[model samples]
Every structure is written in structure tokens, then in C-alpha cells.
Target: MHLLRRISTGGIALCAAAVTITACGSENSGGTTSHANGKVVLSIIVPTHTAPPTAPHAISAVRAAATAINAKGGINGKQIEIRTCNENGNPNDAVKCARQAVSDHSVAVVGSYSNSSNQLIAPLVKAGIPLVGFNAITPADYACAVCYTFDAGNTLSFAGMPAALRASGARTVTAVTLDLAAAAANVSAVEQAAKAAGLQTVPPVKVGVTSTDLAPAVQAVIGSKADAAVSVLPTEQTTAFIRAADQAKAPFTFGVVDAQVQSVLSQFRGTQGDHVLAVGAYPPLDATAAYPGLVQYKTELDAQEKTGDKDAATRDSISLRAWLSVHVVAQAAAGITGDITAASLNNGFRTAKDIDLYGIQPKWTPSAKGHVPGFDRVSNARVFFMRINNSKLVPAKPIAGLDLNTGKPF
Candidate 1:
């Protein structure tokens, strides 16, 4: 009955995905690549096994990428070795991870997740290392010159929410956002986008990160009489709010989940998860489109999972971002005629244009124009929209006002 249902998640599984590889050669901590045991080395810094366990499976994602590459003769005949660092969600630890990347002489830091991008980007930037496809979280990340983001991060997601809701036939929207300053900023962005989309907005119902009882918040959404409501919340709070909304049967559609929450949308089942939209940098793992990247990722990740690596079994947005990041580096490295060292990789990424990821994401350029004011380094401003149906996420049509390239809605 809706454009949302026009596509189904079922698609033909592709045999193999193509990848780019480079002849890596030896070299330094100061913008050069150093290998251990004659292997091309890259590192991923993630907060795994932390207090809140942020992207614990990201390490496996990197590992799986390496495995897939190695299976095909290992990035131009030399096996790729991935070194992982657990930042533990601490700023100091994040800095340590960056410093470690510098000391270990990693060619690039790919697909890292950190709340401390301000701290993490410093050492890598000084060492002339590029951050590829990292989870763009903070203002520092969006503004970092050396950080290459496939996703425009939370701000763009918020900016795109209004158009997505409006496209879903919603004229009035209410916000359910966390009380933190970042969430408030996102809500503000949503308000602006809503105005541009000609959608009416209600003052957000703010919930604390620690707020467990979301029934009252759902009541507030019900009182707003909005046709749709969006959230800017952490994973735990999002789950709680959705559950509360489902229990109370709120009259508005809920949606616009971030990568972190969208990764695990399957955890929400039946009516509780239906009709919600999600925005992400990459296509969903069960994307309706027959993306070669998705097939390759599933194949590689499943291989790792078969080996009894429990972490590999945990496929979320963090890991998928990591997987895509490594592939980006590898694909870029393939074009290098000389040494595939840190300097070469960094230079390649900086000068890259129209790099395609086989339908996994939008074609990205490191130096794309029309940058958003605060998020100057967000090269790929396009956001993919997905909807939950039958307790799963599937690709949905591009909603009006959602494309950042359509105009600077952010």
C-alpha cells in the first residue's frame, strides 16, 4: 500500500565480490608503513569489552575483511594483518589507541568507533595517517581533515529525519531525544529540516540517558498529536522508549534510529519494531538490493563465525563500518604503483575521487564539494534510509529532503 513496501529484502545471492589490491612494500612512524613478519598491517581501534561494550564485534569485522582479502592472495601477494586496540570507551584510552597506531606504524586506522575522536584524531593526524570510514560521532570527527567518513554521522541523520517522516505521509512530528547537549543539537537540526520539509514539529520530550521508565515519555508523544516521532537517543534508551510506545500504542510512527540502534533492530520484534525508519551510512545487511559488498561481507563474516569466533557472530553497524573501512583502504591501495606504505595509502585516500563500494554505499570522494558548515570533512553526505518490516530492516526509497546534496538542510 506504500512505497515502503514496494521492495522486498529477498534478492539473489551473488557468487563473489570484486576488490582492489595493491603491491605493498616496506618503511616508519612518521607517515610510512611498517610491517611485521612481512605482512601488510592495518589497525582498528574500537571500544570492545568496555563498561557499555561499544562495538565489541568491530574487531572481528576487521579480521573478517583481512581473511577475505587473504583468501584472494592477500592484497597483492602479501597477507594483511589487522592489529586491534580496545579503547574501552575512555578518552585517555582512545588517545592511547591513537598513539599506539602511530607507534605501530599502521598505514591507516579504519572503521574505529570512539566517543573521543577529538583525542583519537590528533596523533593520527600528526603522523599523517588517514581515518577511513570511522563512525562519525563528535564535532571533531566531522571537522577533522584526515578523517574520511562514509556517513555524515548523527547530525545528518537528524537533518534527514524530517524529510523521511514527511515522505512517510507524516505532516506533524514530535521529537523524543536524550537530554544531553549532543542530542539537543540533533533535535535542533531536526527542527530545521522539518521546517524545510514543510512539516510541523512539537517540542521534544526529553528523557535522561538513565531514565528507565519511558511510559511518561510515550504519553508526551501521544499528547503531541504528531503523525510521527523521531529519536536521538542511545541504544538502551531507544529500546526502552520503543517498548513503552508499543505498550501504550502511541498514534505516531517511530523512527530515524542511528547506526548503533539500527544494527540491532532485529532484536525488536512484531508490532514493537514495525513502521520504524533507520538511516545509515551503508546498506543494511539484509538490504533488498543485490549489493556485491553485502554478499562478500556475509561470506567473509560467516567464515569467521564458523571458526567459533563469537565476536564475528555479532554483526552490527560498527563491524559493518569496520569491514567497509578496511575494504576502502584495500581498494585504494590497489591503485598504488609504488609502495603501499602509510604515506601512499594516506595520499591515495586524500586524492581519491568517485570511489565505488559495489553498491554497498554511495560513491564517495575524499574531496567532495558542498560541505556542510560544521561537518566540513563529511565527504559522503548521502544517507541510506531503511524501514523495519517483519522484525527486519530493508532498503526503502530515498525520501525527499533527506538527501543532504539536495540542499544544505543541515
Candidate 2:
């Protein structure tokens, strides 16, 4: 498949009729400036008003990374400027953010969190803009040729759950997921991964996205007589499921995506969270002994917090992902010697070597050759496991590797 489709400047002008395209009239607008002391702007699109309230943390991380990058003489001697647009958990707003990025002449959209990937990708792909460090919340984000996702998001966690659960002494697993399309995809991925791991899985119980009661799902899991259960719901819904499971005295261990485990810890007391596993793209922030990246992240976060940044102090999976995204953008941009345009930045990314997260995540080289089927442009297939202990997440041993195209461990 031909991934890169370059549109003529006139085509971009004509395409403006399809949507409400923001005009790029100013120097810091949609087109990159040729000024000697010009700044390279990077746009970050995140949801701040919607259900999953983690966008602020991600936004703060982007700003913090930009601050750090600028302090070190910036990328390729040009200062990095970060512009943000809140998607507000709406598809139309996501499109608007994409238009804003294009209008701003952003080198790339880095470390953004949005569920409306389909709406976001069209404008970006048309403008030859690359999206990096975004969560794979939808099929388009995974399949878009112009997008380079670092992590497989929930899919990575689901794929690694079976092995993590087996290591935790779980033999049979039951899956609980939302009735949304994305959740269904996660369930299928998990099922395949479970089979590959030599683990047995029962039929998954689907819950409504807006459902407040999770007793039925918990009852189904308890009745399944499984040794472990996996939940592919939002953070709030996952918390409800866990609480119901705890109240019913479910025997099976519980597992969720890394992002869901952050605030839900306080909901489970004592041994409630003991056997709960959280599979993530990066290691725990406290895992300083093994991953020096966590140490650097913490230091920067702490500094941001001390300077009155609200999002910096509250570290979560989304924030960490955003931080990594900014690093990836900076690392790629630092290697460019010529003009840093959208195409040039993407070329730098495609050729980047040793793209490591300081042992927090496995080294990955983002290239078309590394692309996996079904996972679209995602090249990174490594996941770290963590178990919740007394309301705290502790790192599990041995990061699991998977061939995302096959949904099996490599």
C-alpha cells in the first residue's frame, strides 16, 4: 500500500472547502517560516473535558519536555514551541485540532491523546504531517500510513495479559470488556494472545459504556471459575468492576490496561488490588533501579510541579506516553541538518536508531519495514507488566515481546 501521499499546495487550498480549515496567515501560522531565528512548532492534541480525564497530564508532559529541550539549546539550534488544542473528547473537535496543527505549520503532532483518530488523520495525512506518540484508540490511528504510534495502547496490555496472569499463577482467564467497537477489538486481540500463551479463556462479558452497575459482569467472571479476569473498560468502569468483584469476593485475579490502574488503586484496599495486573508500554516511574528513564522523567516532573504545574505532579500512563512522544520528536529533529519540515521530520524518524526509553521501554526503530499487519504503523511490540500492591503499582519481571501482526509472543 502506498502510505505517503503528497498533496500539492493547490490541493490543500482546494481541500479547505470540505471542512472548516483554519487559515495560516501569521508567521507562526500553518506554514513553516524560513526566518533564521524561526521556531519549530509542535502541536499536541488531547482531550481535557471528556470522560477519561488524563489529557492535562499529557499536555503538561509535552510542555515539560519542550522546556527541557529548549534549555539544552533546542533541537538543531531552533527553539521548540508547543501548541495545544483540547479535543474535548469530541470528534469534530479532534478534526479542528488537526486543522489547527496544519494551520500552525507544526513539524509534527506529538504525544497526543484522542479517540477520534479517523477525524484527526485525514487532515494530517493530506498535509503530509506525521502523528507520533499517540494512543491507538481507534482503527485509523493504527492503520493510518502517516501516523507512527509508539505503543499499541490497550491492545499491547491485552496481548501481554495472558503471560502476566500465567506468571501470577492464573491458569484460566475470563475477559470483561465494554460493548464498544474498540473494546471488542481489544477482546479479540487478547483472546488470540491468550491462546498463543497456552492459556485458556472463557467467553468475554460485554458491558455498556455508560453502565454504572458491573455486578452482572462480576457475577459472570465469578461463575466462570477462571483463575484470572481481564477488563477492557475505561478507568471509571474498570474501577467499578473491581469494586464489584471485591465485594462479591471473586476468586480470580483482575487485570487492566496500564492507564486504568492509576487512579483506581485507591478504590481497592488491602488485598483487593494485590493480584491486579497492569500491562503497560513503559515501566513504573518508581522502577529507577532498572530504568534510568523513570529517574529522568521524575526529576523533570518534580521540577515542573515545583514551578506550579498541576499536571506535572500527577504522573500517569498518559503523561508518561506523552513524555516519550516528545522525546521521540526531539530525538528525530535533533538529527536533521537541513530544514525541519513535516517531510524532513518524518524522514528523520524513519531513520532514527537506538530509539530507547532508557530501559523503561525496549528500543524500537520506527520504519515501514518494521510495520506489522493489523497494527498498522506501530513498530514497537514490547510491554512491561506491573502488579498492584496495597494501592501501589509494582513492576513485574521480564518485559513481554509480541509480534503484533500475529498477536503472539516473539
Candidate 3:
């Protein structure tokens, strides 16, 4: 039997069994096109009610991308229209947004942030709509055949921590995380990766997600004898831990997932903020010359801000990822010679050999079989490192591409 299956749909062949003609409906099926309006509609779903104060910035980035694309003669000459939905940081609401995308005949759901992939994936796949540039918060984001996530998310960053710490001259590392199943899984993955790199890892110290006091976690880190500490906690917890570490005079080098570093740095200044590593999926947004996508993003965002959008000026990993996602959608649609429908977009994505988001992310090519184990759908495991210096984040190292499944540098 062939390891890969060929699925035929609308006279186009797809390479994987995970994608099907029935699931990715025919383009001429009169599904989501606005016949009267002649507009290609896309949807962006985000969590406005949930975590990450940067959620609003993500939404604003989507709007900015859409506006800029429209000004440049939209996808395939049809002016693009973007529909925004708030997932409310809940599974049921994610389902609602997915259904709305289907009902509205959206070509694709681009660059939305939600952890409720269990509820969102099935509906989107059944509707023949792809979730492009999705945040890989759950297993579904990595395993769902129709879902395409460009960046590796925090898991890859955590997996790469051991090597990063070793490079920083640390022989032993300790992890501080919340007492959640996901947190435990992340710590375990990091431990395995660190061990593969020949670095000793201490057992993870768990704390309550809502606990404001991090003195115990700080003390535990100091007592663990680890030379470095990694935090997989949310923004508030990370900030609390940093402050606690400073107060306790913990001497270990510290790092947090790139997404939370901005929040943590915003609360600190000068040398106090220095030395805190922020590991992430993409390069620092400050390196605009290296990543032209950042320049485009800032330009569009500045335009939106001039129009009085409060969140437009907010540039962070969340917003940058969202901006990259929309650009990918436009790039795919622009390559298609025919109508830019859901099926065509899926085909374009599957057949795409090189998807470079103007240096915002590494080159990506989707696969029928996953490039990494567990995250069978993810295509790349490249990580970028940044260090907080004087209240600003600066690049610490060039991008490191890794085979996360093997915990080896790619």
C-alpha cells in the first residue's frame, strides 16, 4: 500500500487521504461566493474575551492586512472582504465561528487564535474551508489535515529550550509551569529535548494558574541547583515569577516563551529586564530589514492607527503571526488562475512548494504526512531567539531550524 493516497476532487488530485473531495467541496458548488457583490470573503476568528491582552492587536492586524491587500487590487482582482469573529475563548463559540465561516462561504479562515481546535477543526474540514495560520494551541491544530499552521508555536520553542540553554553555558535547567495537563506535556517534551542535547533537567515545578504569588516557584527554582530556568506559564504568571526571582535573588538565567516576553518586559526596565530570553517561532519584529513582512505589517498597522484604531499600533508576536497568515492566503489566491474558492485555495496550498512569508517566517511547504511526530500536519519547526535589553527585545541568535520530533537541529 502506498504511504500516501491520491484523492481526486473537481478534476484536481490531492496527495493525502486526510484531504478529500467531499470535505473540500467543489469550487463551482455555489458555496461561498458573493455572486451579486463579486467579493471574495475571508474570515478571521480570534479570542477577544480570553487570555492574552494582545488579542485586540491580532484583530487589528487582520484588518490592516485586508485593507492593504484591498488597496493593492485584492486577491485575483476581486476585492477581499474580511469577517471577524470572536471565539470568546470557548469551544462552543469556536464552533459558532466555524459555522459562520461556512454559512458566509468564506474562502478560508485565516490567522485566528483559539485553543478550542477540538470544536473548530471538524466543522472547518467538513465545510471544505482551511484554517490558515492558526495558533497551534491544541493537538487538533497540529493533527487536523485541513488545518495549516505556519509557525511551530510555543511547543517547538519549549522543545528547543534545552539546546538554547546549553548554548548559553548552562549545564542544568529547571522548568516552572502551571499544574495543567498541557503544561505537564510541554514540560515533558522540553525535558526529552533537553536530555537529547546532553543537558540535565530537573523535574518541573507546578503552580496554580490563578495563583498570583510565585515565591514558592522562585524558591524552588533557586533550590533546584539548575543553572537556568524556563517558564511555560501565562503572561501574568511569568511576570510574577520574574519579579519573585528578582526578589529572591535567584541567580539562574531565565527565559519565557516569546509570546509572553513582551508583556513581561513591559513591566520591567533597563538591566533588570536584560538576560531574560524570549524564545519564539519567528524572528524578532525589530529586524525589519531581515523580515520585510515586518515592514509591511508596521506600515499597514500605522495606517490603521492613523484612522483612530487603538490596537493597530500594537505590534507583537500574536499580531505579526496573524499578518503573516493573511499574506499567505493572498499569495495562494494570487497564484490560482481560476476562481479563488475553498477547493482552489486548498489545492494551491497543497501544491505550494515554497511559502515564504516575506521573511516573517521560514519557508514552509504543507505535507500530507506530518514533518514532525505528534504534530503530523506542521511543516516547520524553526525557532527564533530574542533577549530583553533595556526594556526592548533584540535578536540573540539567527533562526534555528530543528526536527522537533527528533530534538535535533535541522
lDDT of each: 0.69, 0.70, 0.70
lDDT digits (tens) for residues 90-181 of candidate 3: 88988999899888888888878876766777778877787888876554455555677777775555555655566567788878889988
* Stretch of 10 with least lDDT, candidate 3: 3-12
lDDT of 1 by residue, 266-300 (tens): 67888886657777555567762566778778888
lDDT of 3 at 238: 86
Give candidate 3's error at residue 27 in angstroms: 14
Alpha-carbon TM-score of each model against the true structure: 0.85, 0.83, 0.85
Which lDDT value does model 1 have at 83?
Answer: 81
Model 1 bad stretches (over 4 Å): 1-30, 179-183, 370-379, 397-402, 407-410
